[model samples]
Target: MDATWILRLDAVGDGPRIAVKDCMDVAGTPSTVGCRVIAADALPATLDAPVVETARRQGARIVGKANLVELCRHADGINPWTGTPVNPLDSARVPGGSSSGSAVAVAEDEADIGYGTDTGGSVRVPAACCGLVGLKTTAGRISTQGVFEFSRTLDTVGPLARDVAGAALGMAMLEPGFTIAEPPTGTPPPLARLRLPDVDPALDAAIDDALRTAGLQTTDVRLPQWRSWITAAKDLASAEGYWAHRHLLDRSEHLEDRHAGGIRQGRDFTAAQVLACRRSGRAASAHLNALLDRFSALALPTLAFEPPRIGEVRRGSMTYLTAPFNLAGLPALALPVPRGAGALPASLQLVGAAYTEESLLALGAHVEAALAANRR
Candidate 1:
C-alpha cells in the first residue's frame, strides 16, 4: 500500500492536506480506532475535537483518517484490521505505532504535517523510525476531546513532521496562542544527557557525538527509578482503559483480536490496584519532577535500538523507549540523528518539563540544524 491519502483542504488556499490518525474523530469521517469489527458502526463525529477544530480554523484541510494499531495499545505497529503502516526508511521494519500512518504520511511527503496522538511514544517512535520529527506534548496541554480514549491520564494529541519547524507550526495551529520561542543564537547552554543503562551503545555514541558537534555540553545523569515509573504508568493505563471500555466489552464483540485481549487484561485490574496505581503515578511524577528540575532538558535515545522487523512486532518482542515520558506527563521531541550498524534510522529524544514545549521545540530545531550541517 502507498499509505497516502489526499483530501481537499477547505481552509488552506493551495497547501497539501494530510491524513490524520484514526483515533481522532473528524466530523463525517469514520473512526474505527483500528478495529474492523467496529468499523461498521463507526459514526461520523458531530463536532471536531478541539485540536482539529483549531487546525481547521487556522487553514488546515480535513484529510482522511490515518491507520493505527488496534486500540492504540501497542508500541510496535501491527494492526490486524488495517495492516501495519510500512516504515518508509525500511519496508521490512515496523512503523512504530499506534500513530503509525501519521508518521509515515509525513515521512513520505504525502503531507507536511500529520496530527497524531501519543500515549506512549506513538508519535515519537514512528517518527524516529521514519526519519521525522515527532512531538509528545505535556498532559492536558492540547485538547483531546475528539480523540478516542485509551489511557485518559496519558493521552495527549501532538504532531509529526519531517522537520522541527513543521512540527512546531502544526503545534501552533492546534494549540491556542502557542508562540515559537527562538533559542539563543549565541553559545548555547550545555545539553544534559541521561545515562540510559542497557541501551544500545552505538546509538548512544552517535547521539553523544552529535551533541558535542552541536556545541552543547553533555553531562551524565542517572535516573535509577525510571523503571518504577514505567511500572506505575502501565498499571494506571490498564486500570483506566478497563474503566473506559468495560461497558463496550460487555455489550459488543466489536473489538479487534489484540484489543479484545487487552480489554480482558484490563478487566483483571482490581479497584484497589487501580487506586494504588494512581497513587504510584503521583509519587512517580513527583520524583521525576525533582530529577528534571536539575537539568534544562534530559536526552536519551528515542529507542534502545533500531526499528524491528514488522513481523517481530506481531510476536511482541520489542516495546518502545518513548513510553516512560507519557507516564511522566512531560514534553518530548524526537529528532532523527543517524542510522545504526544495521543502517536503520535512529533518533535522539529530548524531554523537558511540563508545558515546556516551546523550549523543547526550540532546542530540537537547533539540534536538527546542527545535524544537517554536520551531514553536509
Candidate 2:
C-alpha cells in the first residue's frame, strides 16, 4: 500500500534511465494514469507526449512507468488499483503524490531522473517527502501535449532528481535550452522569505536555519491574500480536472467513491463559482508577480510540515502549501535540507517569476551547496 511500480520496460539499455509518471504518454506504452478502469481498456500510445519525446530525443531511456494516486486526485499517493511508490527516505511516511512513483524511482536510484506533473504540488510534495530535487516549471514552459489531462489549467510537467545538479540536467532534457545560470559571483541570489500563518513552527525554524547557514540574504515578505489564493486555485483545478476526466463518470463504479465524489462536486460547481476563481487566480498571480519583480525568487517551505505516515496523512495540507505558486504560473524548485543526523529533511521552495526557472534553479543549487557545507 505504500509503494509499488506500475510497469517497467523490457530493456532500458544504456544511458540515463528515466521513470515517467504513468499519466504521460510514452510510445508503445499504456498510460493508465494509475487508474484500473483506464488500464483495463488501455492501448499503447502511438506517439510519445511532447515532453516524453524530448527525453527520447536527448537519448534517455524509459525504464518504467511510475504509479500515481488514482485519477491524480490525491496527495497521499495511495492508489487502490496500483500500489503507491514507497517513500525511500522513510517507508512509514506517505510518498507525496500524484507523482509518487517518480520520486521513489529517483530516490531509490533506479533511474537517473523522474519526469512528473505538478498541478498542486504533485512533483514538489513527493520530492520533498523523498528528499529529492523537484522543479515545477512556469505554466506552459514545458509542453503537456500527449499527456493525460487533469486540471489542464494548472498541470505543468517537471523533473524530480536526487540533487540540484541532477535536477537541472533533467530540466534540460525536458526543455531544450533550459539551463541553470550561475550566480554572478557564486553566491545565492536574494530571496524574499514569505511569512505564512499556521504552518508547523519547527519547519519554519528549519527554513530559517537553512537560509542562515547558506548566508543567503532574505527579507521577510507577507501576503494578505495567501489563503484566498490557495482556495481559488484549488477550486479552479477541481473545475478543470472535472472537465478533463468527466468521461470517467460513465464508469464510476471502477473508481474509489471518494475520487468519484470529488469529481461530481466539480461538476456541480456553478459557472459563477468557476468564473470567480478565474478572476481571483489572475489577481493572485499579479500580486505574486509584482513581488518577484523586487526579488529574484520567493522562498518558503515546500510543505507546511514533513510527510506523515501512511493512513495518517492530513489531506489538503501539503497541497495547500504548494498550489498557490501553480496558480501564479510561476516556477518553483524544492530542495531538501538536512534536519538532523537521522531526521527527515525539510524542503525549501524557491518560487520565481514567470519563465524564470533558470534563476530559481541557480538559487536552489546555491542553497544546496550552502547546506552541504554547513553539514560538513
Candidate 3:
C-alpha cells in the first residue's frame, strides 16, 4: 500500500504531525479530497483552516494530507483516486472511512493524532474500525472555516487516537481552553445505555462486559424515534448538500464519483420534503436533548458489525449505527473494546450533550483504561 497519501507524515515545528482528510485546507497544499476532477483545480490554500492553524500554533506539524472516501460520500473508506487505507489491526478489513487515512495514520503510529472531519460518523466510524479512540465534538464546538463543506449543518472537526487521554489532548488543541472536568470526588454519575433494536448480539455483549469491568452502573433506556431522527438527518443533509454542490453537478463530468450520485439525488428532492425534514429535525433535537438531560451520556455500539473486508464494503451492505449523533449535533466518543475473534476491533460510542466534550472524554478515559486492563 502507498501509505504516503494516508500517513501525511511530515516533520514540522519540533516533532512529526499528520494532516487530516484532504477536505481540510493546509496552506499551499492541494485539497484533492479524493477526487481526480478537482485535483487539477485544487489550489494550495493561502490560509490554514481554523483547526489546522490551531494545531500549528500549538506546535503540531503538518505532515501530509490523509486519504478519504471520494467526496466523503460513504462510511466504507473507498477512494478510486487514492487507494483506501488498510486497517492496521486487520489489513483485510476496511479502516472505516471518509476519515480513512486519518484513522490509519494514527493506528499505524505514523502520527500522534490525525485530524479528521466527522459529518455523519466519519471520524468515529473509522476510529472504531481501526481500534482507536475518536471524538466527534458538538457541531460548531470547533471552527470549520477552510474545511470543505459536506453538509454545513452536520460537519464537525475532531481527532482520532489510540486512547482517551490522547484524544483529550487533541481536543484541547483543537478547541482552545478545553479541560476535561474532573469527576466528582465521590461516585460518578451512573452510565446510561440506549437499547438499539436489532443491534448485533456480540456487540451488545461486548459493551456489557466493558461497562461491568469499568465498574460503572448501567441502565437501559429507549429512544423510539431514533429512526425518524436518522431520516431527518439524511433529508436535511441532502437538501443542504444539493445546494452547496449544485454548480459542480451541473458539469456532471467534473464531479467526483462519491459526490456526483448523491448530489444528483439531492437536487431532485422536493421542496415539501426538505421543509418537512427540517421541521422534523428541530423537533428531534428538542426530544433528544430532553432525553440526554436525564443521563450523563448515552452509550451504544460504535458500529453494528465488525469491520468489513476491504473489498467487501464496496457492496454497501454495512449498517450505520453511529450516524444519528451527527444529525442531532451531539458529541460522541468512539472507544475501542476488546478484540474479538479474527483480531477485528469493535467499539462503543459514548454520546454526550452538546458542548459537553470534557465530560465525554472523562467517561471515555475510564472505559478505555478498563478495556486496556482487561486485555492484560
Off by over 4 Å in 3: 1-9, 254-258, 314-319
Sort order, lDDT high to low: 2, 3, 1
Q: Estimate, for each residue in 147-218, the C-alpha lDDT of model 2 and write its tens digit.
A: 888887888999999998898889988987878986856554478999999888988999999988888889
Instruction: Please identify which of the two predictions, 2 or 3, would achieve the higher lDDT against the true structure.
Output: 2
Model 2 alpha-carbon miss at residue 62, Å? 0.7
TM-score to true structure, per model? 0.92, 0.96, 0.94
Checking candidate 2 for backbone clashes, the offending pairs are 3-84, 3-85, 3-86
Superposed by TM-score, candidate 1 places the C-alpha of residue 132 at a distance from the truth, in angstroms, of: 0.8
True-structure RMSD, every candidate: 2.5, 1.6, 2.0
lDDT of 1 by residue, 1-376 (tens): 5443312223446544556788887887668787755676777688887777788787777666787887787878767657777888888988887788888878887777888888777888888778889999999989889889989989989999988889888887787578677777766555568886778898888788878767788778877767766777777777788887676675446666666667667877787987777776667667666766776688888888778886665332233356778887888999988644557656989988788899999888888888878777
Residue 193 alpha-carbon offset, candidate 1, angstroms: 1.4
Q: Give the TM-score (vs. native) of candidate 1.
A: 0.92
Misplaced by over 4 Å in model 2 are 1-3, 11-13, 185-189
lDDT over C-alpha atoms for residue 17 of model 1? 58
lDDT of 2: 0.86
Which candidate number would show the highest TM-score if scored against the true structure? 2
Residue 49 lDDT, candidate 3, scale 0-100: 89
Looking at candidate 2, the ten consecutive residues that score lowest on lDDT are 182-191
